[model samples]
Target chain A: MASFLRKNRPLLVTLLIVAAVLLWMTNRYEPKVTASILLSGLTLGALYFLVASGLSLIFGLMDVLNFAHGTLFMIGAYIGFTAYANPRLILNTLPFALALLGGAQAGRWLGGLLPARFKQRWQDSSFLVLTFLLALALLFIGVRGFNLEKLVAATATATGGVVATDLAQEAAGRFLPRIILLAVSGLFLGLGLSRVGTAEVRQRPRWTSAGVGLILVAAAFALIPIRTPGEVFLLSVSSNVRFVLALVIGLLAGAGLGALIESSLIRPLYGRVYYQLLLTLGLSYVGGELVKSVWGTVGFYMDIPAFFGGSGDNCPSPNLWSWFSDHCQSINVLGRPFPSYRLFIIALGLAMFIAIALLLQRTRLGIIIRAGVQDSEMVQALGINVRRVFTLVFAIGCGLAAVGGVAAAPFLGVNLGLGLEVQLQGFIAVVIGGMGNYVGSAVGALLVGLARAFGDQLVLSGIHLPWMDGVVRMSPSIARASTVLIMALVLLLRPAGLFGKKD
Target chain B: MTNILEVNAIHTFIGQFHILEGVSLTVPQGSITALLGRNGAGKTTTLRSIMGLNPPREGTILYAGEPIQGKTAYQIATRGIGYVPEYRAIFRALTVEENLRIAERSKGDLAKRGDLIFELFPDLKRFYRLPGGQLSGGQQQMLAIARALVPENQLLLVDEPSEGLAPIIIEAIVAALRQLAAHATVLLVEQNFRMASQLADRYYIVDDGQTVSSGQMADLVKDRPLIAKYLGAGYAGAGLVPAQSTTA
Candidate 1:
């Protein structure tokens, strides 16, 4: 059948088109179902992109599997939180930027701090021992300083800023350097955009700067004092208060730092190693250790202040969550009102998705990245600074992850392991999408996400099987199983990935 | 008249097995010099050590009077020295254009020099768009040499340049070597004696990891009968080599 379909290309195409349309019609949506599916998929897919990208590059370029990449994603988020909350640290936009930069620099310096002979001999596998040893040492230290009593919480930002979606309270004269938040967001965008092989960038962004710029601003706002319209700025920060600017700054800083790391440490370090895949394991462990050092494993999500922050969950949120539970004004369209929360989240995700798509498709950086994905050695040979492009690609990937982290924080629990599970999925998505193809990854993510959602959701309540694993009772989503299935299918059918040219 | 490169009494070891023991050779400016040796006699290993792809345990490899015994291949390349390794290390996954690009880092533009290389091997020009891997052995060898060329190349270390080339291709290579000698210096390690004899200005022979013969290419020509005695070929009757040359 496979050979027949392959030979009869036009017949195959017609059958595929018919099947797609039929499937689409069968899965028609009401707002709530659509939105819930969309939200989970976006957050999940974004997380995968974040973790898998690093893993892929580590393996694809260097050939390192990095069994520990999940740990690194967790670590980066923790670092973002710690940098935001800690005192006597670099404050404000610029300072926050520096802290993130420092973290990444530290990762690189530590990652590369290996003996010459060992590095030459072990190559990528070399990092496994060197980094694992360093991580184990740090782990020993961590156990001494902060004992592991795991506190499980969703969306726990490091500074203890709990997710509260009350628009009225948020605007009720709590924090006003709205420009700073905008600046931080702008900086996040900039950090994401500034990557040499940027997918797409705003030509004249209102708030576009490096992580350092955002950090300095966050610090200045926190420490320097800002007297804006009906807003009180305090020097002594509260134990359970929200540093809105800090989170924003942290995102920007983390993004930039991630970029620098991609270039200075990753490219050169892996260049020496023989099997690039093992780089992931080293990077993951290093990331885990770094996170453990900063946050000490007790996740915190507290309130910043009532005026600049929301007093309660009832207060309503301007962020997507609020737009969902409170803000989305229900309207009668065709005499039926759709579930508002699902619609808003879905829309927000769609907008971001479209924007990302355009960024990858319609920009010069995107073109180079897409091309470089297939042929990096050639790109360098063409007088393009391939090293710089690699760094930028990494930064952009990190920045996207950060954005997804913040946006999805309200929906899922934001803890160390948030990016971990999805990281592997990202690899699967990229692989299923055909390793380096951007459009293919997106489609693959959605397909995988939807499949998982369906697998988890679809159930015959009336019929009960007495003997089944706990997962069946706990909603067995294909999310966990889908990756392996997809990978196996790809291996058997399209080993090169969906969009990949056969090597 | 000036020695571009000089290796003096170099000794190399690969895990205790001594290779290139007491080996010495010199490369003169704007001229071809051949380092001839049997398999496992450490000709390729010497080139690798010179490029810092391998470090020698004992010896001095001096390039332009600067002792460059320990430098990375990239660093060695940037220092006006291009090594066309014996294996033809053309980045297999990369296209011909990309292969040229990675090797394109001289003061002058690499594009202009590429033109001259293609002119020497017009077959490469005809299939310039193809991937380096797709090219035939001779084409890859040509691309490999073309990859090493620069407008003001201080020195070129070519390993087994004519090893597998056809007679016609070998002629083209010899002609190109002569042309390159009009400008850049060359250190050739050749297996084809005829090819080396036509192009080399000086010859150094290594037997069992030790230098056995050293003289001008012109001098070796007059002592043609000695090839059978020393190298086990060419010389007709007497076992001893004769010292005779038009220059002398």
Candidate 2:
């Protein structure tokens, strides 16, 4: 029992700190308002955890200082904006394109019925021809039937005329020529990516499916008018459905981008860590600039689909979802009402944390990855491809960042600098928690979030007391610097971070 | 026997420091080759170079008649060469079973060899679920060797396996090596002359990042002056020479 206490002392201390904070808060403010503030803090902490978990994992396994992680989060927000805004259109088009490819496969299967002598030629030419025809058919239907040009025009007009004009002009200038080029490139890229599954590629059973998925992602973008008013495309999608689809798209895009970056840029820079750090820092800027170029500098106020209220008195309750409204409406703690969306975000964060924990602890891949973190050469000598593990870990980390971005989009709005604040919070969380320790990152994120929330509500704000004539006040900068102060104290006391190994 | 691995006068540099200059050796198929030298004699560097951990800047390493100096460590490892580092670089956070499990290429193959491994090191089975860091020094060495054994490797590079081990444990490791040598070729680096001479078929003596001598282990044992010249004074009491192995 003593040993158990010794083993979990850090956890106990953290709990004590949390309890003390809560007790102090309840004493100072109205119970309901404090509860609301605490809930807001937890939601923010959860979002930070989602982002920091990825940064921690990637750094732990690969020793990569991925400064571009926040950039990936920003990209995820944009992906959410593009794909989630019109979930119905993208989701519908996805199946149609897949079915067309499936039909092409059916044509190939039918070709298998031909004479044995013609088998080679049929495979070589007939399959390509069938896919090409189907692709052309998809293009025709997508462009003419969907009125892609008008969609582009409407989206441009709705947002700002300048960025849309540039996008449309660029598309119009190279639409035909670019489509042909993209189709060829997409074909090659698909074929190349398919070959990466070496042993499975030799079996060739899933090659067509792999090819279809790759081609759809790589070439399908060309068919959609770049300037399509996102909301118009999303008109038919239900709120819940739109959010889920957007989350999925954001995750996949972030993961894909991470994979590409790791494989191409980060992989080569292994064993040379400072270079990796510099390159990623440069990439973060590049990524931010690229987003600004496309999306413009203005913040896009995300449409709160499921939520009932906007930021005005017209809607009294900020509890947007029906589920929250029905369940939590009557449970006002003091003089203030608690928003349920923050609670939902907290739950989402916990779910993600559990999923990742299960993934790392319960699976064969997790064991290999954990072992690889300690001795990659030993893992390699054991014949496990350590590089592949590194890539996968990096991708998973980026995907989590995307999840954070999408989840926060409704609350914060999608903007050019979306990743900056979250990224800084994530870094501080990682540092305070312990570099490379997952649970530490989560704990750090919560502490940082709560600190900020408390700072906003209690510390920096001018506090009025009944006994005192004047209000007590602190500088805004002190509140902002509190995150760094916590980190500095942790570093000075426990340099390896709260849970870091004393290497 | 035909050579399984041939290092052709390779020069390896670790940063600005030239570690292995013009070092060369050969391990024949179905035989153990001992690379013996005094402390800091580029023995570990040679092993590391062959494993592609610190690749050679000059010359070549031919494994199974193909040049492998340019390949990454994992690529070299996958091509049927297994490495055990001098420090017993086991995953300390992982369990004994997990350490071996990660090294295994095929699950079925590991299952087949699992019983055989336990038969060799019964203590491993006793602490199968314990973390590698919690293991004693002897057990860690055993675990490191056991991890390398899981993959179906044709060539095994075992570095200083006897380092920091009791004579009794060293005997157990030597016996394990003999059993291992039946299926795969072994390239061993050892400071203990008694063990290296007994276990190795051939010997290569390295001095100042260069191969100074090469012969059958039996012939090497008779060369008192050569042994004294390279192995330092610590081995002189072991009766290899009247003088120390090295002046330093």
Top DockQ model = 2
Candidate 2 chain A, poorest ten consecutive residues by summed lDDT: A194-203
Q: Over the stretch A407-475, how does candidate 2's per-residue lDDT look in tens digits? A: 788778888788998999999999988998888999999988888888778654477777989888877
Residue A317, model 1: lDDT of 42
For model 2 the local lDDT of residue A137 reads 58
C-alpha RMSD in Å of predicted model 2 compared with the true structure? 8.5
User: Could you give candidate 2's per-residue lDDT for residues B1-248 as a string of tens digits?
Assistant: 89999999999998999999899998999999999999898999999899988889899999999999867677788899888888888989988988888777776766878877887888999999999999999999999888787878899999999999997888888888888898799999999887787788899999999999998988877877777788865664463532222211
Each model's TM-score, in the order given? Answer: 0.61, 0.81
Question: Which one is best on TM-score?
Answer: 2
Best by lDDT: 2
Tens-place lDDT digits, model 1, residues A1-503: 88886655533453475368336534654555544454455545554554444445434443434454455455445544443343212222232233333333333333244355754454435444444355444334323422122221212332333222122122213333333333333332323222212111111122223333545455544542322211212224553243444345445654665665555345545444544446545666677666555445655543322232333444334344443345433322333433333343345445555775675556545544544665554333233455556666666556555544443333454466666666767677777766655555665665566555544444312223448544344435444785578668766776777665577
In angstroms, the error of model 2 at A497 is 0.9
Model 2: how far is B170 from its true place, Å? Answer: 2.2
